[model samples]
Target: MKVVIVGGGKTMFFLGRNFAAKGYRVVIINRNMEECEDLAKQLKAVVIFGDGSNAGTLEDAGTASADAVLAITPHDQDNLVICQLAVNRFRVPRAIALANDPDNVKVFEKLGIQAFSTTHIVSSLIEQRATFEEITNLMPLGEGKVNITELVIGSGSPVAGKQLKDICLPDNSLIAVIIRNNQSIVPRGPNELHLNDRVVVITLPENHGKVLKMLTGEE
Candidate 1:
């Protein structure tokens, strides 16, 4: 698969190296020609120096045939504009963005941008590891700051049958989505608690245990 990244930062470099090492074609585009040249040389990537939002630049970067486009600039507005161009103008099949602010992630999601805030995600993962030493499949938002955990609610749990609002979630934890019968549901307060439900939760490291007990049968 061909992937294009619109930024030449640490994250971009890491992604390019990993993908290129794994034999995927990668192109890294950046406004700073020096950083672009240095990173491209280090990773053996196809580096393009230009403004990512420009149609000509995108075309020159081979965006037309890219399997995925990632807009990960430090600036949120730039990232959004890049993503919009990739999706709307270039018609890229997949577009992802990097968000500097966690609060902005939801807004991006609402705009149909597949994006995440590295700071928020990483911090939550670190916190999760500190709290739940046994928890695995932590989404690696950071070394341990935030986490995306697949929590299972077994039978006879305290929260079974209780309305979602009644369940005491740690302030740091959020029930982002629920999966039942292979269907994904973005949870709302009106969604009632049910036994044997598997939930995908996003939370800060500190509040994972409380969420675990509520999710699994153990208190």
Candidate 2:
């Protein structure tokens, strides 16, 4: 995957490193030349020193073929514009924006942009900790309509003893992968779920609740 990050803050700095370590093609854009140089040296990622909200800067960063574009600048308006440029002009498959102001989350969502605010995430974590404890990761996909989540299977989970063919998953939900005992299993109709299995799934956001209920036996 090719990822373009529009920011020089700690978020993008660590994100660039992690993505690069995972073998993704990473690019970093920042308005500060010194910061760009430092990031390039530290991450070994392609760095462009310029305003990411500018179409020309994004073009130079190869946004045309980017698999995912992240707009995490400090300014909410700049983040929105960068995301809009990535989705509307460059046709990037995924555009993610960071909403500094909690109130702008709805505005960004209304415009078909996937936005995340730190305040909301931290608060949600506190509220949903028990319910989502098994979730290793959760990311919005397809502009927030769908979510991809990674979950670890426990011994008493509802799907632990069933085969994929026998389990009735929610509509639009698909198990993308199963990692069991250090082995990655491509899920098939006859594949049996086992305890300690790490599963990755994709599903519509509305169906996420049903999926959790089915997997964890919680209402």
Candidate 3:
């Protein structure tokens, strides 16, 4: 697999290193000469010093052969343009952009580009941590439309001691796995939830609160 990363500071360097470590062909494009020099020295990726939003720059970075293109420039417009070019012009299979403005996420999606908002993600994480302390991990999927949450079943949890079949989960939600005694168990209809068991639940973002309430007996 080949990946092209456009614009970023530490993120670009680390992503390039990680992709190279995974044996993927990594290409990084940046306008800053100093950063490009640093990245070229530290990472095993092809580092090109140029504005990634430019078509010629992307071409130089081999975007045409990239399996995935990620545009993470600080400017939302630049990110949008880079992603658009990668998908529409280069025909890359996957094009992801970073939306500096939360409102631009939908705009990017409407233009057929996958996008995520760092601002919205950070705020959501803070809110989730404050509201649901039992949630160990919360991962957003489908661009924050769906969430996979890990919840620790407490003694007061309504689903504790109940079989999966009897627990009434909200629509578009299901308990995917149960981790007990350091072992992971694929949940089944006959499987029963126990106190302190860590459960991985997949649910729509709208049903996050309800899933927590049902599983942890918390609002």
Candidate 4:
């Protein structure tokens, strides 16, 4: 996957290094030449020094064929604009914008862009660190009105034999994907579950218990 990032902050460095290590082509954009050079050198990613909100800059950064685009600039408005161009004009398959304020997510989602609420995730993690073994919390999207939780199939799960269509899954939740041998399978309603398969589910936090039970066959 080729990923284009419209930011040069710590987040970009973290993401760039990870994707590059995994053999994906990553390009990071920023207006500051110094930051660009530093980030590029450190992460071994291509750095394009230009305005991230500019369509021309995105074109030069190859947004037209980008597999995914991230609008993670510090300014929320700039991130929104960049995301709009990537999603609406460029039509990148995955257009995610970093939402600094939880309140602003609705506007971005109205434009049909996926958004990340860093504020809520960080806070929730810090608060839950003492209690949960490992937390996979989904941030609110569309608006700051909903949240999702994901859990994987544990060892010896009883749900493995049943097809999704056969199992009476949670009404408020959906089976998102199944991973086997580290390969992701986006789940379909008729998909069959296999033993030892890892699953990632997207469901409201209120429905987490039901989804977990459906996945692990444990209440």
Candidate 5:
């Protein structure tokens, strides 16, 4: 897989490093020369110094061949334009944008771009922390319409030792993967949930609480 990351700073550096570690071809585009130099040295990626919102810049970054494009620039307008160009111009399979303002998330989604708002995610996490202790690594997708969450099964969990087919999950919710003792298992009809198993679930935001309650027995 090839990933093109737009913008700079810690997020770009870490994202580039993670993709490179996964053996994906990583390309980074940044407007700042110093940051580009730093990232080129720190990450095993092709670093291009230029404004990512520009078509020529994206072309230079090889966006045409990128499997995915991530636009995480500080400015929301720039991020939106970068994503649009990546999708409509380069025909990239996946394009994600960071919406600096929470209100822009829906707007980005309306324009056919996947977006997430850091402000919204942080606030949601704070609220969830007060009520749900068992849920972790909660990620909002589809502009907060969908969510991906992780929960661990304990001895007292309602779904513990139950086969996936037998668990009554909420509508639009699915246990995508179960992590047991450092191994990942794709959930099947006969796959049984075990104690200490970490399950990754995908569900609509409205069904999140219900799914958690069903799996962890927590209200």
Candidate 6:
């Protein structure tokens, strides 16, 4: 996969390195020459010095064939423009933007751009930790109609030691993956739910509560 990242800060640095390390062709487009030079030296990906929001700069950065484009600049407007150009003009398959202000997420969403806000994500993490002990992660998808959630199996849970096929998951939900002892497994019907294992599931919004109850056996 080819990924084009627009920005020069910490987000770009980490994402460039991680994606490059994963063998994906990565490219970074930044406005600052010094930051671009620094990133070029530090990361294995290509670093281009230009304004990412500019269509010509993106064209020079090879955004036309990019599998995904991430507009992660601190300025929300710049990110929006970059993502819009990538998705609408360049026809990139995935266009993601970073919302520096949590309040900008709605605008990005309204514009049909995938937005990731660190501030909102961190706040959600803290809130989820406080409110739901069983749910470790909650990613809402399709305008919150569906969710991808992670549930940690407890020792006293009724589903523990039971085969996945034997457990009746809520409608429109299924176990997608299992993380056991740091190993990720594509769960199968014969797989058994073990204590301390983290189970990731794709479930509908209305069924989310039921999924939690079914797994943890707690209200």
What TM-score would every model get versus the actual structure? 0.66, 0.63, 0.91, 0.65, 0.73, 0.71
Look at candidate 2 and tell me the lDDT of residue 171: 76
Candidate 2 regions exceeding 4 Å error are 130-219
Lowest lDDT sum, 10 consecutive residues, model 5, at: 127-136
CA lDDT of each prediction against the hidden true structure: 0.80, 0.87, 0.90, 0.76, 0.90, 0.88
TM-score of 5: 0.73
Give me the overall lDDT of model 5: 0.90
Give the TM-score ranking, best first. 3, 5, 6, 1, 4, 2
Candidate 3 similarity to native, TM-score: 0.91
Tens digits of per-residue lDDT, candidate 2, 76-153, equal 999999999999999999999999998999999999998988887676445444576788888765545677888888
RMSD of 3: 1.8
Q: Which stretches of candidate 4 lie above 4 Å from their native place? A: 131-203, 208-219
| Error in Å for residue 114 of model 4 | 1.2
How many clashing pairs per prediction, in order?
15, 0, 0, 0, 0, 0
Give the true-structure RMSD of model 6.
4.6
lDDT tens readout by residue for model 6, 1-219: 999999877868998999999999999999899998899989998889999999999998899999999998889999999999999899999998999998888889998998878886676556545656788788877745677989899975789999999998877899999999899999899999899999998987567667777888776
Q: Against the true structure, what is every candidate's RMSD?
A: 8.3, 5.2, 1.8, 6.8, 4.3, 4.6
Off by over 4 Å in 6: 130-171, 174-210, 217-219
- Please report the TM-score between candidate 4 and the true structure: 0.65
The model with the greatest TM-score is 3
**Candidate 1 residue lDDT tens string, 10-96:** 878899999999898998889997897798679878899999988889999999999999998888988888888899988999998
Evaluation by TM-score, superior candidate among 1 and 2: 1
